[model samples]
Target chain A: MKKKVLLILLLLPLLSGCWDELYFKDLQIVTLVGIGGEKGDVTVHYSFPSVSGGNGVEYLTAKASGSSFSDARNNMNLKTGKVLDISQLQVLLLSDKSAEANIFDYLDSLYRTPRNRLSSHVALVKGELDAYMGNGKNENSGKTQDTPEFLTQLMDTIKEYSLSTDYNVQDMGSIMFAQGQDLALPLLKMSEESGQPELDGTALFNDFTYTGKSLDITESKMLNILQHNTGKFLRDTYIFEVQGREVPVTYEFIRSRKNWDIGETSITIRETIHVEIDEYSVTPVIGKGEFAELEKKLSAAIENDMQKTVESMQEAKSDAIGIGRRVRAFHHNLWEKGDWHDTFSELDIQVKVKVKVERTGILD
Target chain B: MKPVMAPVQMFLLLFLVQTGTFFINFPSLMIKAAGRDSWWLFFILGLLHFPHLWLFERFYRDFKWTKFISLLYGIYWFFAMVSITSYTVYTLNVYAFPKTPTVVVILLITLVLLSASTSKTSTSVNLGVLMLPLIGVFLIFLMMSINNLEWTNLFPVGHMTSKDLFRGFFAAQLPFGGMELYLLFRYLTAGKIGNAKLMIYSGIWLVFFMFMLILSLAFFSLKEFTMISEPIIYLLKSQEVTFAERLDLIFIYIWLAWSIISLCGIAFAIMRLMNIHRVKKPNYVAAFLCIPYIPLVWYTATKTGTELNGRILTYGHMVFAFILPLIVILFNRYKGRKEPAK
Candidate 1:
C-alpha cells in the first residue's frame, strides 16, 4: 500500500501536461499562407478565421514584409495578437515572381518546423499575391466564400479534370530532391469578371526554379495525361469536323495503358486510352465504319496535342513526365554523361496515342 | 529463487529488445549509407543475423557467468539504455513535446525504470503481451502511406559502391545490436526454445523491418534520406488521417511506450546478472543503478550527445555486444564445455 501510494505520487506530476499544449482560445489557427518577393526582401500573408466582438466567423488576412521568409513570418505574428499556429494550414500560395527563384528557400520553414502541416495544397500565383490574397480595399471586402477553401476546391476540380496534379508540401520536397523528375504546380490568376482566383494554367518548373513558362488549360490536360497523373475522373473536349461543320465532342477517361521505350538518343511513348463519350453533337445512328473513323480522328488529334505538349516541356527544359528517371535507372552511361535537363532538351521524343470509345453514355 | 519465463514471453521480450527505439533512425541511416540500394542491402545484412543466432543457440548451453564478462555487459547495458532513452527524449523534444523539460522527460523515464526494476521479474516479461494491440495499430498506421508511394524511387539498384556497403554495415549496429541478449537471457526460460523457433521469430521481425524499409525507400527520394535524420518519424509526420492531422504526435507516444518496455527488459537482465553474482538485494541494486541515467540522458539530449551516441552504438556494439560474445562462445566450445547444465 505504501509503495502504491509512492508510485502515484511520483507519476502525478507527469500527468499535468507539458507547456506546449495549445488552447483553442489562445491559438489563432492560420489556414492559409502566401509568400511572394525575391531573396533579399520577402513578403508573407496569413489568413485565418476570427470570431471577435460577438460577430460571426470572419476570415482576416494579415501581411508583413521582411528580409527573409522566417523574418516575414515572425513579423506577421506581431499583427495577429495571438500565438500563430499552422498545424492546420490548408493552402500555401507562392507568387510567380517568388517561384521564379528557388521555391525551396520559401519552403524551408515548413519543412523544418515539426508542427507545420505537410499536406497543405501548394500553388503558384501568376500575378501580384495581394490581388489574390485580397488587399484591404479590393473586391474581396464583402465576399462570403473563404478564399483559401475556395482555391483548394478549385484546384481539386482541376485535378479531377486531369489538368493538374495533387502536389502537397511534402510531395514537393521529394520531387525537388529527385534528380530525374521536376515539379509542375497549378497556376492561379485573379478573374477579371468575378474578381476571384481561378486556375489559369500550369506552371512548369525546371529543377527548383519556375521556368518562366506555362501551358494553357488544353495543353495542361494533355501533359497530365502523358504523365499518367490523372485523378478520379478525367474529361476532355475536342472540336471535330462532322458533316462539313465543326462540332464539339467530349470524352470521359475510363482507363489507359502506357508504355515508354527508351533508346540511345530518342524515346517512344505509346498509350491506349479507353474513354466513354460524354457528349456527342451528332446523333448515334452511325455504323461501325463511322465509329472507327471517329476513333482514328480522335486518336490523331490527341496524339498531335500530346506531341505539342512534349515539345513545350522540352523547350522549357522541364522533365515533368519523369522520362529522366527511366533513363537514369536503365541507361546509366547516359545519365552520368551530363546534366539531365540539358540532355532532356536534346532528346528525340515521339508520342502515339490510341483512343477507344468504350461507351456512348447509354445511347445507341 | 531464480526467475523463470515461458517461451512466448521470451519471444516477445526478445522482440521488444531487438526492435526497441532504435528503428526510429535505422532506415534513414541505412539509406544515407547505401543510397537507393538501402532496401536490398538491409535485407542481405538482416539475413546475416540468422547465422549469428545459430551460433548463439549452439553455444548458449555452455555459457558460464564470469565476473569480468558480467561486469562488461552490465556496463554496456547501462550505457546503451542511457543512449536509447536519451534519443527518445531528443526525438520527443523535436517532434512532440518541445516544451517539456529534459529533466522532466528523463525523470519520467527514470520512474518507469525504477518501478520495472523493483517489481517482480514476471511483470517486466509480461509487458510485451500488452504491446500486441499497439503493435497492430502501429502497422496499420504504417500501411497508410502506401497510397503515396512512388515505386520508381527504388530503381537503379546496386548503385552504391563497396565503401558504401561497409558504411551501411556500420550504420546497422544499433538496429542489429540486441541479438546477443538471447544468450544472456536464455537461462531464464523454463522451456527450451528450439533453433527453428528462434529462426521463425527472427524471420517475422525481418519481414516487419523490410516492410518499413521498402515503404520508406518508396516514400522519399534518395536525396531526402540525407536530409532527414529519422525518416520513419518524418514518414509518419507526412501522413494524415480523417481523425487526426498530425499522426506523429500519437505515434511518438507509442514509440515511447515501446522504449520503456525495452528498458524494463534490460533492467531485468541486469538484475539477473546481479543475482548470479551473489549480490544481496539485486533488484534494488538494479533500481539504484538507473538513478545515474537521469543526468546521462540529459547530457545526451544535445547535438553532440547524438554524435557521441552514434559512436557508442558503432564501436561499443561491435566489440562488446558482438565480437566478444563470439570469442567467448568459441573459447568455451574449444574447451569442450558443450554439455547443457542440469
Candidate 2:
C-alpha cells in the first residue's frame, strides 16, 4: 500500500499536463482566415466569435498586415486580447492578387505549423479580401450569407453538385508538388445582387502560380466531369436540337468510366457516362432506334463541348485531368521530353464523351 | 535461469522490439530513397531476413554467450535504447507537447524503462500481448486513410537507379535492426516454434509494414515524400474519423507508449545479459544504466542529433546487429566455440 501510494505521488506531476497545456478560455478560436497581397506585402484577416453584453456570441473580423503570413499572424496576436488560435479554422480565403503569386509560399507556414488544421477548405476569392470579409455586420451592410459558415456550406453544396473536386488544404500539397498534375481551386466572387459570396468559377493554376485564367460555372462542371470528380448529384442541362428546334435536356449523372489512350504525341480520352434523363421537354414517341439516335446526338454534343474544355485548359497550361500523371507512369519516353506544362500545351489531346440514358425518370 | 517466457510471448517480444520505434520514420526514409519502387525493395529485403534467421537458428544452439559478446550486445542495446528514447522525445515535442522540455520527456520515458527493467523479463513479455488488440485498432485506423490514396502514384515503379537501390536496401535495415534478438532470447523453444512458424510470424509483421508503406506511397505525392519527415503521422493528421478531429494525437500517444514498452524490452535484454554474466544486483545496475542516458538523450534532441542517431542506428545495426552476429554464428559453426560457457 505504501509503495502504491508512493508511485501515485510520483505520477501526480505528470497529470498536470505539463507546459503545453492550453486552457480554452485563453485561446480565441479564429474560424476563418483571409490572406491577400503579394509575397513582400501580405495582409491577413482573422474572424473569431466574440461574446458581447450578456447576449449570444457574435463574430468579429480583425485585420493585420506584414511582410509574410507568419509576420501578419504575429502582428495580429498583439491586437487580440487572447491568443489567436487557428487550430479550429474552418476556411482559408485567398485573394486574386495573392493567388497570382506562388501559392506554396503562402501555405508553407500553415503546413509547417503542427497545430494548424490542414482539413480546412481553401478557396480563391475575387477582388480584395476586405470586401468579402467585411466587419461582420453583414446584415446591415446589404450582405446576405457572407459569413465563413455560409462560404464553407457553399463549397460543400458545390461539391455535392459535382462542380468542384473535394481537395482540401492538405490534399492540395499533393497536386501542387506533383509534376504531372496541376491544381484547380474553386473561385468565389461576392454577388452584386445578394452581396454574398457566390461560386464564380474554377481558378486555373500552372505549376504553383495562378495562370490568370478561370473557367465559368458551366465550364467548371465540365472540368469536374473530365477529371472524374463526380459527387452525389451531378445534374446538368444540355441544349439538343430536335426537328429544327433547340430543346433543353436535363440529366443526372449515374456513373462514368474514363479510358485514356496515349500515342507518341497525341492522347485520346474516352468517357462513357451512364445518366438518368431528369428533364426532356419535347416528348417525342421515341422507339429504340430514335433513342439510339438521341444518344448519338447527345454524345456528339458533349464530345464537342468537352473538347472545347480541354482546349481551354491546355491553353491555360494546366493539366488538371492528371493526363500527364498517366503519361509519366506509363509512357516514360514522352515524360522525359521536357517540362510537363509545356509538353501538355503542345500535345494533341481529344475528348470523346458517350452518354447512355439508363432511365428517363418516373414518367418514362 | 530457465526459459520462463512462452514461445508466443518471445515472438511478440521480437516483433515489437524490432518494429516499435522504426514505424515512425521508416516509410519516409524508404520512399525518399527508392520512390515508387520502395515497396518492391521492401519485399526483397523483408524476404532476405529469412536466410539470416535460418543461419541464426542453425548455429544458435552451438553458440555460447561469452563476456565479450555479452558486453558488445549490452553496449549496443544501451545506446540503441537511448537513441530511440531521444527520437521519441523529439517526436513528442514536435507533435504533442511543443513546450515540454526534452529532459522532462526523457525523464518520463526513462522512468517507465527503469520500472520494467527492474522487474522480471516475463513482465515485459506480457506487455506485448496486451498491446495486440490496440495494434489491430491502430492498423484499421491507418487503413481509413485509404480514402485519400491516389492509386496512380504507385506507377513508375522500375525507375530507381542503382544508387537508389543501394540506398533503399540501407534504409530498409531500420525495421530489422534488433532482429538478432531472435537468437538472443532462446526462450522460443525449437520444438514448439520451428522455422515455418517463425517465417509465418515474420511474414505477418512484414505485411503490416508493407501495408503502411503502400498507404503512405499512394497517399502522398513523390515530392511530398521528401518534405514530410513523418509521413505516417502526417497521413494520420490528414485523416478525420467520425469521433475525433485529430487522429494523429491519439495514435502518437499510443505509438509513444509502444516505444516505451519496446525500450523496456531492450532494457530487459540488457538486464538478462548482466544477470547471465553473474553481475551483482543486475536490476539496480540496469536502473543506474538509464541515469547517464538522460543528459545524452537531452543533448541529442536537435536535428543534427537526429541525423547522427540515424547514421549510428543504420551503420550500428549493420555491423552490430547483422554482421557481428553472422560472423559469430559462422565462427561457432565452423571453428567451434571459443568460450564454452552456457
Candidate 3:
C-alpha cells in the first residue's frame, strides 16, 4: 500500500499538465482580420496559411457575416475544420465607410476578447475591401500571389519610411477611451498605377468616429514629427526658388522636439527639427551665408504647412495633436469650465518652427 | 518539535502573505476610488498600517500563548486561508486555465498547500528564500517598462476630496490583514524584541506598495487604468522582449510561488491552533481541515460571492487585526494595575 501510494504521488506531476491543451497543428492561425459593413450586420474576413501535401503553403481567405463581430467569427469558425486562433493575428483592417460611421462598435470585440493581441497593427482600408483582398498579383514581379507575409512586409516598409503612424489596437483603444485625445490610423488603398495596395496618407479620427479628412504624405510626416512618432527614418522634399531657380532640396530628419505652452486664452506650440541635407538640386558653390538663407526659407515653408494642417484639424474639431490632453494636464480650470471640443475649434493658437541643418551630405 | 524561524524568514513570510494576489487588482481598485491620486492614497494607507502592526505586536507580547488568544488567531487564519485560496484558484481559472474545472484547480492547490504545510518550518522558510529573487525580477520588469511610462498621467495630484481619499485608503488597507498572521507565529521567532522589527516589516511593505502604485499610475492613463481589471498583469503583457513573448505568463508562474508560500503560512497557523503536533500523522489532520475549504472557496469565487467576501474581509480586518488587539492590550493593562507587582 505504501509503494502504491508513492507511485501515485510520483505520477501526479505528469497528470497536472494541461488537460485541454491546444496544439499548433490543430489550429487555423489567422494572420489578417478585416471588419466591415454596418453595426448589426457586420462582415468579417479571415486570411490564413493553408498547408497542402507537396504543394507548398497556400494563402486562403474566408468571409462570414452575422449580427455582431463575435457572431461573425463564430460563423466563420463553422466553415473551417480547425479552430480559428487569432493569437498570431498580425493586422486588422477596417473599411473607410464603416470606420467613418463608427469604428468603436467594431473594435469593442477586440478590446473585450482576452486572446486577441493588443499590439496588432490596425489600419483603415480605402475603397472596397473585397477587391483589395481578391488581387493576387505581386506589384513588382507580376506574379500571382496574395499572402499575409507580403501584406505585412508592405506595411512594415511604409512604417519604416515614416509615411504612416504605427497605430496598434492598444494605442487606438487608449485614445478612444481617453478624454481630450483622438486617434489616427494608417490608410491603405490600391495604387492606380500598380494595382497593389499602397499607403494612402492617414485617417484622422475624432473620439471613436473617423473624420472625413486625411493628411497627405508630407503633412502626415509633419504630424508624425510634431507628435514625436518619427519612426526609423523621415524624408521631406522642399521646392524652393534659390537664386531665381526652383531648386528641389531633400532633407533627412535626424531628430525633433515639440513643446506646448497652454494659457487661459491662447496656446503656443514650438517645434524644432534637426535634419541633414541628403539631396540639393542646385549645383552652386553654396557658402555659409547661402546655407543660412536656405535654412530660413525651409523653416518658414514648414511653419506655413504645419499651420495649415493645424487649422484643418481644428476645423474638423479633431484634437489629433493632443492639445486638449495637454490642457487637461496643466490647465485643469479651463478643462473643467468649457467644452474642450468646442474650445479647441475656436481657441487662439500659434505655431513656431526652428530648423537646424546638422550636416550637408558630404557637400557644402 | 517546535519549529524555529529567524527574523529574516519571518519578515519574508509576512511580506509574501501581505502582497499575495492583492497586487493584481490593486491599481484598478485604487484608480476607481481615487482617480489619478491613487499613488497618494497608497502612501497614506501604507503609513496607517504602522500603528496597527505596533498595536498587534504589543498584544502578542503581553498575552503570550493562551488558549483563548490562539482560538481568535485560528479564526483569523481560517478566514485568510479561505480568501487567499479562493483568490488564487479564481486567478488560475480565469487567466491560466479557462477550461479547467474549478474543483480540480482547488484540489490541486490544496494538495500543494498540504505538502508545504506538513514540512518543517525551516523547509518553508527556505522556500521563502525564493521571494528574494522574485522581488528582483519584479523590479527589473518595472525598470524595463520605463519606455511606456507617461509622466503627465500623474498630474493634477490634489484632485481628490478628503472623503474620496479616506475611502481609497480603506480599500487599500484590506490586504494588510495578512500581517495578522505575525501574531500567531511570533513564538517561532528567536527574539522577543520590541516594535523595532514590526517597523522594519511595515517599512519594507510600504516601499513595495508605493512602488507598485506609482509605477501603475505612471504606466497607464487614468481612463485606461480604469478599463483594465488587473493593471499589473496588463502592464506585464505590454512589455515585449526579443527572446520571449508574453512575459505575463512568466510573471504569473513566478507569482504562483509567492501565493503558495502565503497559503503554507496560513495553513501552518491553523495547524498550530489545532495542536496537530500531538498527532502521529499531523499532515493527515492538516489535509482534512483543508478539504471543507475547497467547496467554500468555490462558492465565494463567484461574482456576488467575491463582493460579499470583500465586505467580510474589510470588517473582519478591522475587528480581528486592529480592534481586537487594541482591546486585548487595554484589558491586559487593566489587569496588571489591579493585580499589583510580584
Candidate 4:
C-alpha cells in the first residue's frame, strides 16, 4: 500500500501538466518596447517577431494607448492571442518628447515586475516614434528586420568604437534613484544619409527627466574618458595651427586614467590619456620640441572641451560624471549640508588633462 | 550521551548553520540601516559573536546543569529553527516559486527535515560535507562578480553615526544568531577543548562574513544597495558569464540545498531537546514537531509576517543569543563555586 501511494505521489506532478508553467510557443516575445506621449495618456509600442512555421520571421509592431503603462500592456494583450512575455525584451526606447517630461513614471511597470529583464538596453529616440519605427522597415523588401536586434547590434558596434556608454535598465534604475548621480543614455536618431537609425550621441538626465541637452560625439568620448568608461580604443582627431598652417592629427587611445580630489569648496578632476599616433598630417621630420608643443596644444584643447562639457552638465543640473557621488563618499559633511544638485551647480569645479604620446607609429 | 561529531565536523556544521539565508538579504538590511558603513558594521558585530560563543562553551562544560541549559537551548532552537525555515521558504516563494502554495512549500521542507532529523547525526554531517562544493560554487560566483564592482562604493567608512551603527549592528546580528546552535550540539565535541575549536570556527565565520559583506558593498552603490531586496542575488544577476546565463537562478538552487542542510541541523537539535532521539519512532516525533511550525511558517512567509520576523530577530537575538547566554554563564560559575563549599 505504501509503495502504491509513493507511486501515485510521483505521478501527480506529471498529471498536473505544470498548470502554472509558461511555454515559449504560447508567449509573444517582445524584443523592443517604446514609451511615448505625456503622463496621463501614454502610448506604448511593442515590436515583436511574428513567427509562422516554414515561413521567414516577419516583424510585427503593435501600439496601445492607455492611462498607465500596465493598462497599455493589458490592452495590448487584448490585441494578441498569446501572453506578452517581456523576459526576453532586448531594448527599451523612450521618445525624446516623453523623455523630456519624466521617464520614471513610464518605467515603473518594468521596475515593479520581477520577471522583466533589467539588462535590457535603454536608448533615447531623437524624433517621432512612428517615423523611426516606420523608417525601420526595409523599403524594397516590404519586410522589416527586428528593430530591437538592429538597434542592439548598432549600439554594440558603437560601444566597441568607444562612441557612447551602454546604459541598461539596471544602470538606469541605479542612476535614477542614486542621490549623487544622474542618468545618461545613448541617443538614437534616424540617419539622414542612409535613412537608418544611428547612434548620434548621449542624452543627459537630471533627476528622472531629460535635461533637453545632449553631448556631441566628441564631447561624449571626452566625458566617457573622464568617467573611466573608455573601451579598448578611442579615436580623436584635433586640428591645431602650427607655423601658420592647419595641422590635423589623429590619436588612438591606448589607455586612460582619471582621479578626483575633493575639497571643502572645490573639486579637482584630473585625466591622463596615453595615445598612439594613428594619423598626422604634419611633417614627419618635426623636431622633438615641436612634438612637445603639439602635445601641449592637444592637452589644452581636450581640457577646454571637457571643461565645457562639465559646465553644460552643471547648467543642466545633471551630475552624470558622479562628482556628487564622490563628494558624498569623501565629503559627507558637504553632501549633508544642502542639496547636492544646488551645490554642484555653484561649486568650484576644475578639469585638468595630460596627454602622453606613447608611440609615434615608427615615424620617430 | 556521547559526542556525535569530530572537531572538524563540528566546525563544518557550525559554519553551515550560521551561513543559512545570510546570502539572501542580510547585506541589504545592513545597508538600509547604516548606509556605506554596513561592511564595517558587519565586521564589528561578527567579532561580538566570540564572547557569546565563550559564554555558551563555559556554560556547557558544567555537566550538572546540562538538562536545564539544554531546555533553554531547545526553546531557543525552536524559535531559531522557525525563523530560518520561514526565511528560506519566504525567499524561495519570492524568488523561485511564487505560484506554489505556501503550505505545499512548507510541507515539502518539513518532510525533508523529518527524514534528515530521524536519521543518525552522521547523515547530516555527511550532508554538510556535500555543501563544501556548493559553498565553493557560491564563492566562485561572488569572485566572478568582482569585475562589476565599484570599489568606491565602500568609501566614507565611518560615515554612520553612533545610533545608526547601533541599529546596523542589531540588524547584522540576525544572521549570526544561527551560530548559537553550537551550544545545542556541544556534546558532539565533548573530548575536544573548547577554545581552539571555538576560535577556528569563529575565525572561519568571520572570514566568510567579511568576504560577503565587502563583495556586496563593492558590487552596488550605497543607494542601489539600499533599494535592492537581495543584493547578493542581484549581484549575481549583474555577472554575465559566457557559460551560464541567469546565474542567480542557478545559485538559488544551490542556496536551497544549503538551506535544507541548515534546516535539518535545526530539526535535529529540536529532536535532541525533545528526547525524540530516545523514542521508538523518532521519525514520527520529528514529524510531530514540524506540525506546529507549518502554520507559523505560513504566517512568516506573508508580507506582515516578514516584518514581524525581522523585529523578532533584531530584539530576540540580542536577548536570547547574547544577553541570556552571558547571564547563564555567570550564574553557572557562581553556582559551581558555592556547590563545592556546601
Candidate 5:
C-alpha cells in the first residue's frame, strides 16, 4: 500500500509537469523542402507560417556546406534565422544533376531527422529544384502555393491517367528496400508553351540513383494497367474508325482484364483492354463484320503499344510494372531458382487486347 | 519475483513498443545495413533471432534464482551500466532531435522528470501499473492507425522465399523488441501468470502490428519512404478524423509518453543498482552520473548523432541484448541448471 502511494506520489509531480507538450498553435509549420544541389553545397528551402498580418506564410531559405548530408542539415539551422520546421513539409524535389550523381546522401539526411513527416512527396526535376519552388509568383494570393499545392497537383495529374498507387514515402521505402527489386518515382519535368509547367510521367531509379530514363505519358498509363493496379485513372480512350473512313480507328485504354500463365521456362501474360470510343456518326453502317473489324484493328493497336512497352522495359532491365515482383510472390521457389528479373526481361509477352466500343454515348 | 504483465499486457507491450519508433527509418536503415533485398534479409535475420530468443529464454530459465540482467552485474556491472545508460540516453536524445520539441528539452524531460519518477516504482505491482498507460496508448494508436488502413496495400501479393519471410520476421523485431526488457523485468513476474504464453502472444501480436504498419507504410507511399523521415507518424497523419489536420502531433505526444515511461523503468533499475552497491545518496549519484550523457544526446541530435547512435544500437544489441542473452541461455540449458526466479 505504501509502495502504491509512493508510486502515485512519485508520478504526480512529473506527470503534472508536461514539458514537451506543444500544441498546433505553438509550432511553426514548414510545408516543403526544396533541395537545390550544386557540386559542393545543398540549399534547403521551405515556407513557414509568417507573422505578417496580411500574408500567413513566411518563406525561409537555408544553405549549408558539408562533406555529408547530416552536416548540411546542421549547417541549415545556422543559415536560416528560424528553426527548420518539417512536420508540414509535403514535397521535396531534387534537381536532375544531383539525382543522377546519387541522391542517397541528401535523402539520408531526411531519413535521420524525426521532425520531418515521411509522407512528403519525393520527386526529381528536369533542371533545378529551386528554380521552380519559391521563386514563382504566388499564384494564389490568399493561400500560399507552398509545398502542399504542388504535391496535390502532381498527384492529381497522375490521377487522370490511372498512374501508380501511393506515390508517398512508405512506398518509396518498399521500392528502395523490398526484396529483389528497385523502386521507381514519377519525375515531372517543367514544360511551358504556356506560363505554367506541367508534370509528366515518371523517372526510374535503381535503388539509389536516377536511371536517366523517362517514361512518356502513354507508357506510364500502360505501366499502371499492366501492373493491374488502378488509381484515379481510367485506362481507356477511343476514337472510332470504320473502313473507307479518312482517319483510322484510335482507342485509348478505358478498362482492362488480364490473366497470366506460367510454364517451366516462360510466362505468357495476356491483357484484354476495354477501350472507350467517342465519335459522331450521323449515318451508321449496319454491317456485322464492321464491328469485328474494329475490334481487330483496335486490338492490334493496343498489342503494338503493349509490345513496345515490354520491349522497352526489358531493354532497360527495369521492372517498373512489377511483373517480376508478382512472379516472385506467386511462385516463390521457382522464382528463386531463376534470375526472375532476367526472366521478366526475356518474357514471352502475348498481348490479347479486347477493345469494346460503347456506342451508348455515340450520336450514330 | 513474479511475472510482471498478464498475458494480454505482455502481448500489448510487445506490439506497442517494437512497432512504433522503427517505422521512422526501418525500411531505409535496414536497406543500408542489409541491401536492397532487405525484406529477404529480415526473413533470414528473423529466423536467426528465433533461436537467439529461445536461447535467451533458456538462459533466464536456468538462472531462475536471479534475473538475467542481475547476472550481468556479476560479470561486468561497469560495462552493463554504461550500456544501459547510453541506451536510455540515445533513445531519449536521438528521438527528440527529430520528433519532439528539442534535444535539450527532451533531455530535461526524460532525465529530470521521467527518470526521477522511476525512482519510486521499486515493486512489481507498482511497475506494472506504471507501464499500463504506455500499453494503453500503444493499443489505441495501433487501432486508430489500423482503422484507415487499406487492404490493397499488402497486395501485388508476391511470393517470398524462406529468405524474404525471415527478413520480414526479423524486421518485425524493431517494433516488438520490448520483450527484451524481460531481462530487467524478471522481478515483476507473478507466480500465477502464464509466462511462455504471455511472451508468445506478445511476439505474435507484435508481428501482426508490424505487418499492418509496414504494409500500410509501404503501400501508400512508396515514393516518399526515403525522403520522409517518420513513416509511422505519417501513417497516423494520413488518417482523416474531420477534426485533426495532422494525427502525427497527437501520435508523437503519445509515443513520447510511452518512451518516457519505458525510460523511467530503465532509469529506476539503475538507481536500484546504486542502492545495492551501498552508494551514498543514490539519486545524487544518478544525477551526477547523468551529467556527461546530456552532451552526447545534444551532439547526436545534431546529425552526426544518428550514425554514432546507430552503430551503438546495432553493436549494443548484438553484444549485450542479442549475443549475451543467447550465450547465457545456451550455457544454462547445457549445464542443466534449475530455472531462475521470475
Candidate 6:
C-alpha cells in the first residue's frame, strides 16, 4: 500500500499541470468593455476596484480610436500606468452609432480572440457612454455590472425577462451567424429622468448594421413573445376602455410558444400563450360574460402587439426569430440551393394567439 | 503472442484513444459535413463500422493468423505508407515536434511504446487495462460537459439533408480508425476466446457514447456551432471554472497520452508482422521505421507547432483513417475466404 501510494504520488508530476499559473493579485483585472466606431476607431474604457483593491468606487473612462481595439488599448497604457487586461471583462456597451454602422468586424475580433469568454452581456446604448463614464456621475449615468455579483443577478433576470434573451455576446453572434437574419441588440437611452437606461428596448438590424428601429418596454413584451423566451404568460394585463385615455395595464408574461406554418407565399406563426392579470388602473365591470370578453380583448391586443413586432423584424430583413435557421436545420438540402434570407421576409406571417388568466395579483 | 487484453478493457481504451485526437476537432468536422446536422453524422458513422468490423472478424476466423497486408499490392502499400506515415507524423507533432530533436523526440516516444508490446508472452496486457481508467476519466469529463446542454439549440427537427448526412457520417470514421485492433485481437486471441459479438459490442459502445457526448458539446455552445475551429478544444478554451485560467490544458494532456497509446498500437502491428515474415532485425527496428514520417510532416507544415489542428492533420487522417481500413476490408473480402492462409 505504501509503495502504491508513493507510485501514484510520483506518477502525478510526470503526467500533467504546473506548466503555468496566473494569480489575480499579481495581475490587474480589466473590467472595461469597448466597441468599434467609424473611421476604424474603437471606443475604449475599463474599470477596476478603485485604490485599496477591495474598495468599490471603480474608475471607467474612454479614449477615441484611430486604430483597432488592441492598438487603442496599447495606447491607453500611455495614459494610465497599468497594462489593460480584458480577460476579466464582463459587460459590453455599443453606442447606437457604432451598432448602426455594423458591429460584425468589432464582434469578430473579440469572438475570435483567445481570451474572450463569449458569455458577456452586450447592450446598445442610445448615446455616448463616454459622456457618463467619462464624466462620472449618478444622474442618467449608464451603468452595467461587470462583476460576478451582478452576473448571477442578471441570469436570474433572464428567467423573468424574455427580451433579455438576445442581449448577450452569444446572442449577437447567433444573429450575425444565422442567414438573412437581421441582428437586434437591447437599446438603452440614458437620461436624468429614467435612472440610466436599463434595457430600454431592442435595436433592429439590416445586414449587420442597425436599422434604427427600437421597441420600447411595452413593445419588447411582445417581442419576447415572438422570440418565445417567455415560454408562457401566467399573468394578464388590465383592460380599461377609457375613451382615448391611455390605460396603464401591465402583463406579466409567464410562457409562450410559437409554431411557424410555412405556406407557399406567406408564413403563418400561431402562438399559444398562458397568462394572468398582474395590475390595472380601473375596476372591472362585473357582468355574466365579462371574464370571457376580457380574455378575448386581451388576447387580441397581445396578438396585435406580437404581429407588429414580428413584422418589424421581417421588414428589417432580420432573421432574429431564427426561422431561416430552423429551415436550415430541418430542410437543409433545399435551403442550400435557395436564397433563404429573401424567402423569409416574403413569408407572410399570420399569428393566432391564446391566453389563460391565472389571477390578478392580490387584487392590486 | 502478447497477453490478451480483456475485450471490455480494449473496448474502453480503443474508444478513448481513437477519440483523443479526433474529438478535439470533431465539432468542426461534423459541422462542415452536416451543417447543423452533425450529431446524426456521428451516430451513423458509429453504426457504419459494424459491417466493416464483421467483415474483418470473419476473415480473421478463417485465416487463423494476422493481417491481409501481404495479399495487398506493392502500390497499395505506397498509399498505405503514405497514410500511416502521415498519421504517425501528425501524431508526433502534436506532442513533441517543435520542442526537441524533432526526429529524436518522436523516436523516443516510438521506443517507449515498442518496449511495452515486444513480448510475445501475455505480460503487458495489464498496461492496456492500467491506462483505461485514466482515459475513462477524460470520457467522464466530456460527459460532464453534457450537463450544460441546451435543448433549444437543437431546435427544429430534421435539419440536415440526406446528402449532408452522408458526408458527415463518413467524416466520423477518423476517430474509429483503431478498428485495426482486429489485427491486434487476432494475435492476442491465439485461439477462439470470444464470439463475433465482441466486435459488435465494441462498435455499439463507440457509436452511442460519441453520439451523446459529441452532440452535447455541439449543442451547448452559445451560438450555432458554425464559428468553432478545432471545435472540442475551442469549446474548452471558452470555458472558465471560476479560477482555472484555461481548460485546454486538459485537452493538451489527453492529446499527448493518446498519441503515445496509438503509436504503441501501430508499432505492435508492425513488430508482429516482422515476426510472422521471419525478418531478422531487432524488434526495436520496426518501431524506428515510423520515425521517417516525422520529417515528412515538418515539410508539410510550419515548424512553429501552433497549427496542430490544421489541414495537414485532417488530410493525413483521411488517407490513413478512412482509406487504409477501407482498402483492407475490400481486399480481405476480395480474397474470398482463404482456407488457413495465416
C-alpha DockQ of every model: 0.75, 0.78, 0.52, 0.45, 0.11, 0.22
TM-score, prediction 2: 0.96
**Model 2: per-residue lDDT, tens digit, A1-364?**
9979979987997888679988989999888899997897889988877777775566678889888999999998888788888898888889987888898887888988888888888889998787666453456644323476677788789888977666788988889988689999888988877677888888989988889888877778778888888778888788888767988888888888999999889999999988888888777516646678778877887788788888988999998888988888889899988998999999999988888989888765
Q: Give me the runs in candidate 6 sitting further than 4 Å from their true place.
A: A1-20, A53-57, A60-66, A77-80, A132-135, A138-160, A231-251, A280-290, A327-343, A359-364, B33-46, B61-173, B190-199, B202-227, B236-264, B267-342
Top-scoring candidate (DockQ): 2
Interface RMSD of each: 1.2, 1.0, 1.8, 2.3, 6.2, 6.4
**Model 4 lDDT, residue A24, Cα:** 87
TM-scores of the models, in the order given:
0.96, 0.96, 0.93, 0.92, 0.62, 0.75
lDDT of 4 by residue, A1-364 (tens): 9958975785676576643467889898988888999898999998787766776676677888998889899898988888878877878899999998878889888866656777877889988776554326567666564555677788777677778776678778777877788888889898777667898888889988998888888878877887777776789898888778887888888887888888888888998888888888676625858878877888898899899889877888888888887787778888887988888988888999998878888785
Give candidate 4's whole-model lDDT.
0.77
For candidate 2, give the DockQ.
0.78
lDDT of each: 0.82, 0.82, 0.76, 0.77, 0.54, 0.56
Query: Candidate 1 overall Cα lDDT vs. reference?
Result: 0.82
Pairs that clash in candidate 2: none
Over 4 Å off in model 2, which ranges?
A15-17, A53-55, A136-146, A243-245, A283-289, B187-192, B338-342
CA lDDT of A201 in candidate 3?
A: 82
lDDT of 3 by residue, B79-160 (tens): 7778777777777766677788888778778777877888776766667787788879977987787866666777777988
- The sequence of per-residue lDDT tens digits that candidate 3 reaches over residues A149-224 is 6668777876788887776776777778667777888888878776767888888888888897887778788778
- Which of 2 and 3 is ahead in TM-score? 2
In model 5 chain B, where is the ten-residue run with the lowest total lDDT? Answer: B74-83
Task: Give the clash total for candidate 4.
Answer: 0
Query: What does the lDDT read for residue A189 in candidate 2?
Result: 89
* Lowest lDDT 10-residue stretch of candidate 6 chain B: B71-80
Cα deviation of A203, candidate 4, in Å: 1.3
Q: Residue B256, candidate 1: how far off, in angstroms? A: 1.1
Q: Estimate, for each residue in B195-302, the C-alpha lDDT of model 1 and write its tens digit.
A: 788789879888878887788888898888877887888988998778887898898889999989998888888888887788998766766776687888898887
List TM-score (chain A only) for every prediction.
Answer: 0.94, 0.93, 0.92, 0.90, 0.78, 0.78
CAPRI-style grade of the A/B interface in model 2: medium
lDDT of 1 at A267: 88
